[model samples]
Target: MKQPPAVKRLFGLYFHHFPFVMLTTTEAVFLHTSILIFAMFIAYGIYSYLPATIMFSISRASYYLFGESNTLGANTLQY
Candidate 1:
């Protein structure tokens, strides 16, 4: 079955916005450009996740940006 063009476009938009909605950083990093790609990954993970689990990791992602080094921060963790 073919999906409608509108649905596909919506998915693309969701994926694009996924990164921004996921990464919640209070402290602005001095090196922001470097952070953008990685931030997107975090967003992807958040959106891909089931609702119940998203919050737990979302908080961790926030802390991860604050210089905490862990697998979660790296987007290496399996869902």
Candidate 2:
């Protein structure tokens, strides 16, 4: 048996809609970043992730500009 056309169309619209926002405040952005970093730590404990490591490296690489840390620079250089 098939659903009637009206009901099917309603379901189609409902399924395709995605309401997530693309931009947000700096604090909200950083809060999510911190949460992700914390989650990454938990994930790493379960199974190491290369992408998360690379993201951390790129973020830290900025510190090299102010001579705060060379670790990020070295990481970017290697990968």
Candidate 3:
């Protein structure tokens, strides 16, 4: 019996990184699942933290550029 294209692709992606070795279907599935879970955790961490990091950087930059006081008059044009 032939494997489906998706299964073949998954094996190709996960197997190529290791030395040529035999793996039972269960072991392969477990390895793939572990890798996927790890990837999701990393992605979630970035998603949760990136926005706050960007906002902090922006505010810090603005404070340095605009100085401690808002001395500009209402007529002053901000670039």
Candidate 4:
């Protein structure tokens, strides 16, 4: 009668985008779908990674700034 939480969440996410999804059927549609899913995964990964990365960077920088050294903005990408 009831679905599990993970299943519900999964379906919820799928249905949430269902209305906007353009259903397609053409030559090599499976290949195109695979590529699109791969791109979506990459985008989602980067989207999820960004906040944690910035938080860790800021935390490490602040630690170095206050506790370990007086140097701030020492690391830079030289191009």
Candidate 5:
């Protein structure tokens, strides 16, 4: 059975944006992982900004790139 035009379009978009989506998903996963690692390091009295800053920047960048700026209820940290 053939899919409808809308479904095809959606699939096309998914394929077109798959690279970016995958990167974003990886960044999100890494962000959480880093948070846990950083928290542990902090508990051990380690001082560093690499994990927090990198993850925060990536999230902010992704938010802007994903059209969160024009969407309702955006965090407003996009600039």
Candidate 6:
């Protein structure tokens, strides 16, 4: 049976943007899956480590800026 026009157009678009001269179905699936997994790993790393890193930086900055003083209202006005 012949493919529908929409299916033909989709394939045309896919090939038009595809970088490789040829790609088997399995190769395409593996390539896409690897890219997705790599992206997820990067996202997970950022999600796990970014907040703690940001908080640590903020805490250090505040400590340096304010010293050990308990009087924040007065110190804030001085700067």
Question: What's the lDDT for all of these models?
Answer: 0.69, 0.68, 0.78, 0.75, 0.71, 0.80
Highest TM-score among the candidates is held by which one? 3
The ten-residue window of minimal lDDT in model 4 covers 68-77
Model 4 segments more than 4 A misplaced: 1-27, 68-79
Please write out the lDDT profile of model 2 over residues 33-78, one tens digit for every residue.
Answer: 8878999899877676777877787767666565656553455644
The candidate 6 region of ten consecutive residues with least summed lDDT is: 70-79
Model 6 TM-score (2 dp): 0.62
* lDDT value, candidate 4, whole model: 0.75
Count of clashes in candidate 6: 0
Q: Which stretches of candidate 6 lie over 4 Å from their true place?
A: 1-18, 69-79
lDDT of 3 by residue, 10-41 (tens): 98986787643677778877877898999999
Q: Residue 53 lDDT in model 6?
A: 90
Tens digits of per-residue lDDT, candidate 1, 1-79, equal: 9999999999899668656545656433433556787899899888887675777777677776776554444666558
Which one wins on lDDT?
6
- Comparing candidate 2 with candidate 3, which one achieves the higher TM-score? 3
Tell me the tens digit of each residue's lDDT in model 4 across 1-79: 9999999999889657554355555634775688799999999999999998998788787886787443444575557
Off by over 4 Å in 3: 1-14, 19-21, 69-79
Clash totals for all candidate models: 0, 0, 0, 0, 0, 0
Model 5: per-residue Cα lDDT at residue 28 = 65
TM-scores, in order shown?
Answer: 0.24, 0.30, 0.65, 0.49, 0.27, 0.62
Candidate 4: residue 78 lDDT (0-100): 56
Clashes of 2: 0
In model 6, pairs of residues that clash are: none
How close to the true structure is residue 28 of candidate 1, measured as C-alpha lDDT? 34
lDDT accuracy of residue 39 in candidate 5: 86
